[model samples]
Target: MYALNDIVEMKKQHPCGANEWKIIRMGADIKIECQNCGHVVMLSRREFEKKMKKVLKKADSDK
Candidate 1:
């Protein structure tokens, strides 16, 4: 299961040319932020599940 502050890769590319996002919040709904463009979007867990390709990496202290 995903948690807050996890970095994941999505199946689709962002308009800003980034495919990475940081999960900011998680519950029935989730909030994710684009790494390159600084955009934020909210999605349901089901939606996120469908869109996510794979998790690149989780957020670490160095990130």
Candidate 2:
């Protein structure tokens, strides 16, 4: 399962030209940050699950 502070890859690239995102928060809703332009966005867990391609990095123990 994905957790906060995890780096994930999406199927499509963002407008800023990055496909990498960092999970900043989790729960009923999820927050993700773009690695390229420092953009932040919120999405539902189900929506995130549908678009998530893979987990590139796992969260740290303290994150």
Q: What's the TM for model 2?
A: 0.89
- For each of the candidates, the C-alpha root-mean-square deviation to the true structure, in angstroms, is 1.7, 2.0
Best by lDDT: 2
The TM-score measured for candidate 1 stands at 0.88
Best-performing candidate as measured by TM-score:
2
The C-alpha stretches of model 1 lying farther than 4 A from their native spots are: 60-63
* Candidate 1 clashing pairs, residues 3+ apart or interchain: none
Q: All candidates' TM-scores? A: 0.88, 0.89
- Write candidate 2's Cα lDDT for 1-63 as tens digits: 788898999888899999999999899999999999999989999999999999998877545
Local distance difference test, each candidate: 0.88, 0.91
